[model samples]
Target: MGMNYFHQLLCRSSRWERASATQIVPWALKGLDLGDNALEVGPGYGANVATLRTRVPALTGLEIDPALAARLRTRKFDQLRVIEGDATAMPLPDTEFSSVVSFTMLHHVPTPALQDDLFAEAFRVLRPGGVFAGSDGLDRPTFRLIHLGDTCVPVPPATMTARLTRAGFTDVEVHSAATYFRFRARRPA
Candidate 1:
């Protein structure tokens, strides 16, 4: 799926860059075990990859955009592996990652059903006791404007919590702000 002009601009914007560093990366890193490998979905321009690599040395990023994935590879982080793939139907093995992370990207999943598929995929790839953490935008006008023509299904905290639980994630927690939300869940040990 090719990105529209607005989506492309957002991916390369400084605002987005700053958010990845200041907001997303820190939130995603919380409660993660450094000894375990990690995977990040939709890591645009790989901003979070460097920060995440500091904690989890072996970090792989799954980006849906082939162009973005190729761009990420050029950075040459020895511990970072960039894979061009879909989040809903990831081309990855089950129980492979100790943690799975996504940052403000779930809303781009087209529909709530597809977003649930992403949750299921995350659960499928996580090892027992593995953590899945991420932040996403709420259904607000400001965030909707940012997405432009892209598919944006801003999920509410309660809905997200329920979906995570249904996806077999335990210890699910969803925190909501006025315009955004963060979540953390664990695959049962």
Candidate 2:
């Protein structure tokens, strides 16, 4: 996932980390079980990892960007594993995780079709009755400015719901907030 220089800086900023911890991640994950093992797809810069680490027993991050993944690995977070790979074609095994999540990262998938492939991968890697939940920034002017020269493909809530269903997830839910959208889907038990 390519990004402008400013965009990259913003992602690594302390302000973004605080906002993700206090605002985005909590709101997106409220009431979610996240079971024993949780997988975070495209955890750019590990912004959501702090809060998620508190929520889930074991956390694994799958990142497309090698640098970001390596940086996370350097941190040596307790009970966290950083994997460098594409979410659309994961290196992990099937029915492996109790939950699959992404936060403020789906838009970097480049295309809607590839985003669907990511969804399918989530479904594939989740155990029966596992949850796939996440939040994506909405398509807006300010974000567009920051995302110039970035591979951003906004996942509109309505369209995302359809995509999740097509990926064989049941009980799909997509809710829009002021700046972003939160989605939840379940692999049938």
Whose lDDT is greatest here?
A: 2
Best by TM-score: 2
Off by over 4 Å in 1: 1-3, 76-79
Give the Å error, residue 72, model 2: 0.7
**lDDT for predicted candidate 2 compared with the true structure:** 0.91
**Model 1 residue 148 lDDT?**
71
Give every collision pair in model 1: none
- Candidate 1 has a TM-score of 0.91
Candidate 2 residue runs with Cα over 4 Å from true position: none
lDDT of 1 by residue, 1-189 (tens): 345688778777778777778877687556657456899999877767767877886899998977788888887456588888999999999999999998888877888889999999999999999999988878877777767777777777788778999999999888876676889999999
Worst 10 residues of 2 by lDDT: 71-80
Residue lDDT tens for model 2, 4-108: 999999999999999999999999988999999999998888888889989988999998898888888987466589889999999999999999999988889
- C-alpha lDDT values of all predictions: 0.83, 0.91
RMSD of 2: 0.9
How well does candidate 2 score on lDDT at residue 57? 84
